[model samples]
Target: MSIQAKSERALCEITRSIRTRLQDVYGPASADSLFHAVERLIQRKRRTLSVSAGPRFSEKDALLITYGDTFLSPDRSPLSTLHTFLQEEAGSLFSFLHLLPFYPWTSDDGFAVTDFRQVNPSLGTWQDIQALGKEWKLVFDGVVNHVSSDSLYMKAYQHGDPDAEDFFIALPPETDTRSVLRTRTLPLLHEYQTTQGPKWLWTTFGPDQIDLNFKNPKVFLEIIDVLLFYVEQGCRMIRLDAIPYLWKELGTSCAHLPQTHQLIKLFRDILDWVSPDILLLAEINAPWPDNVAYLGDGGDEAQLIYNFTLSPLILHALVCEDASNLTQWASRLPPLPAGTTLLNITASHDGIGIRPTEGVLPEEARRCLTELAVRHQGAVSGKKNSYGTVCSYELNVSYFDALNDPAVQEPQEVQVRRFMLAQLITFAFRGMPGVYIQSLIGSRNNLAGVRKTGRARTINRRQFDLTEIQQELGTPGHLRQSVLSEYRRLLSLRRKEKAFHPDAPQAVLDLSPSVFALKRGGLPGGEEILALHNVTNRTVRVDLSRYLSGERYQDRLTGVSYARTDLCTMDLTPYQCAWLKKETLISA
Candidate 1:
């Protein structure tokens, strides 16, 4: 069937659902009015669907996570500078580029979006964005949960404009909302003294940001419209930022509400019709169970969910040199639905999230991470727990610094290897690996940036001069060059193997406490992979013959060939990882 035809049919069902939600939130009379308006919107415009084909996610599919201004230069615009860097130094290193929120912002480093439709003037023009789109698949952040209070839409609502009545979440002081989840320790309400009256807006992340009310059907439609606008701007992936906080009821804990799930399903249906290949990435940094829930029914919700647990747990395993906790948590993971997969990354624009480690990591293990961060001159940020006590929420440090403690004064080579070991663990997982720009370039703690911004996360969100970074990378045997070269090599090799597919059936192997072993089976053919990593500093021997079926075998990364008899005993050096293929597949 034609995309437009399928969308027309789906539009009928969506309109009905919206009408029901409207009635539930705003009553029958108002619902009828809203439904009429939504009908008009559907008739006037539908999301455009292009007929051209795009690349699907596969073993070759790796993502690069970076802020739009990550590669900055005095001589050129940030976007243009970034484009040139990718073309010259890092052509095709990543299959996809996840451009973090680049909208005009008042605070929170672009999360507090002042304008959704317009590109940040400082970042460059929309044409630059389109130019990059010609090469890489782009993932745009849909910061629909909140907007900057300085936004025109917020100003209109603050000035008592009737058209903006349903724009934001404002409530009476007497309303009880103690049950709501607290993503930050700031006050729940941010007061705004407007011309008409003194109003309070719900601010989930912080004061400069005001949450939108999904209960107000108009606000929901506004989000949908903005999403369509993103599609038009060449986004192949739409990441729903903090979507769990979209729906709130006074008496309930407003995290992952049923209404939120319904809204996501509606989005999936709409996006499938509008752009079938555009992947919806859900950024839920909650417990492991809650995180995977976004991949509902395998395909109805998000196609990709941030593997939040992997970051903290992998750090724990590497720092503690014990994979027991990581193995335990991963072993208990429920089977994911067929059409959906997980997106794993060692680092991001934000700090390493700790909430995802609630049950998986022991208190001592958690403390170990924080102490190591402090020793490395890294800041540990926290949020208020339910008991009103501040607890560590995240570790703010560059992935390089996070890997090794400064107190020990480890050699730079050791730190680089340790960091790459973590990346190896990330690639070994049955998920698409996302390489953070800082980790790839071997960046250290950006203390100057933090001092300038007075934000802990700034320690990792350091902007670099593309030319200088490239020079350092070009210098032979330099730490940056070594790290960048190894990273490129790993990615280049990882892309060609079939056993590293994101949807492969993976089983955690209980080999040894010091080693993290995973068996990835069910590739393009009968080929399988036995991934082994020695997280500890000492060499660990594992009898791989038990896992090997036939004679022809090779390690995917090193290309070291061996017969099944020789594979019976294998020793992995300190922080070494090997992707041992069962048999050489001529086709792959």
Candidate 2:
């Protein structure tokens, strides 16, 4: 067949798929109109702009997750300050920058977006974001589930503007929302004095964040346009924040509804047609099954889903001093669908999520984890379950503090080693590792910030001044310097090894309860690296003879060579991590 004919056939198929997905929620007539509108948008984009396909996955494709204001300067905008830091200090340590919502926001530290199309003036302008994009691939947040109550759409609704009347979900005050899933303890509906009358609007997150009504096709189209604008602003990936709660149904739990998945597929289809290189990342913090559902058969939904369970599981393993649960969960992780991978992250702006640990970590263990966080000067946040009972939702603490107790007067070196071990485990996983900016410097719980802001999540969201952080990182014996130096060395070494590629084969090794091991590569006589991490506070000996095919292997971190005869018994010091590659492979 001719190339033109083949292209036409492919486009028709995708258009039909999009139409069917829209029909499932908006019915045939509405679906027809929405599909055509989307097609026009895609065509117009194709005709007016040219976006190159982004670089594919490699061993070096790690992402640095940070807010635009993570590194603030007295003279410059936050985004510009961050750009300078990335170029000078970070260098090429990261391939992508996951810039957490940089748009104007009313609350939730940028999650409650007041404006979708413009950058927060406190941060830099679009030019600054594009400049960062030139240095590193960029990830932008699509906070589409809700908008700030102060947003123009909400203001219009308050004024009873006909165009904005159906923008949000407004129901009767007596409406039953018992079945609606809640991520916050705040009331599901907040009464608003609109021009028409007093109406109760659905506020899934909080009253300051009003939920959008997807039942209205106009809202969906508007969001699609917003996301496309992000692509034009040079974002290679768009993170759909709080996406699982996008579509609501009256008679069922308004989370992960079929319509929600369909809408994601529609977004995927449009992006695939217009800018094929752009990726969709779903930020779902639910249980394993529900979290993985966002991947939608691997190719049609989100290209990336946060590895939400990994953070809590790692904490549980380290605190409990047992790797059994972590190993078991890793062993059973199903093969990812094509074109999809998890974004392996141990820490982020928010606290470590407890919801993702459901079914994997027992209730007793979770409770134990929460209690441990408190002991370490952390806090626990709760959510209301369907039973109207409040349950522990997340542990709000810095990743470093979660693992190392602040009251313990241990040697700083010991704390740094133990913390890096947790980070090493994340790197050894079979996905792209996302490093939070705070984790890079081994930051502790900011209890002062939490107390000041009256938000538990503020414990980990401390914004650092550029001069102060630079001074700390420059000090020879400082904790921040030590952690970042080691982290940089490990990251540099990881990029050089082909075995650490995102698509490299991984096999979990069940050697010892105190050890977490992964065999990467070595499929069909390829290069292999045996990654071993000791998650305890004491030395643990592991036998590696059965796993090694070479007579000698060298530790990539320390460059220590071990003969096969010596592999039967090897001692990993407390909190030590080793990436062992065959001596022959290293020599070749």
Model 2 RMSD vs true structure: 1.5
List per-prediction Cα lDDT, in the order shown. Answer: 0.83, 0.89
Error of 2 at 265 (Å): 0.9
- TM-scores for all predictions: 0.94, 0.97
Q: Which stretches of candidate 1 lie over 4 Å from their true place?
A: 1-43, 51-56, 523-526, 586-588
Clashing pairs in 1: none
lDDT (Cα, tens digit) per residue for candidate 2, span 487-535: 8999998888888887788999999999999999854656799999999
Candidate 1: count the clashes.
0
How would you encode candidate 1's per-residue C-alpha lDDT over 1-588 as one tens digit per residue?
Answer: 998897678767756666676666567888788767655654454545452335457888888888889999998889999899888877888888888988899998889999999889899989989898999999999998999989988988878888789688788766666677786888777788777688887888888989998887778778877887888889999999999988888777788887787778767765664566778999998898888888886467898999989999888888889999999888888888877888999899889998899888888888888888888899888876543567888899988888876567667777887889899888879889998888888888999999998999999888888878889999998888999889889888877777788877899988888888998868555557888888988888888766877777888888888888877888889888888875546355
Best by TM-score: 2
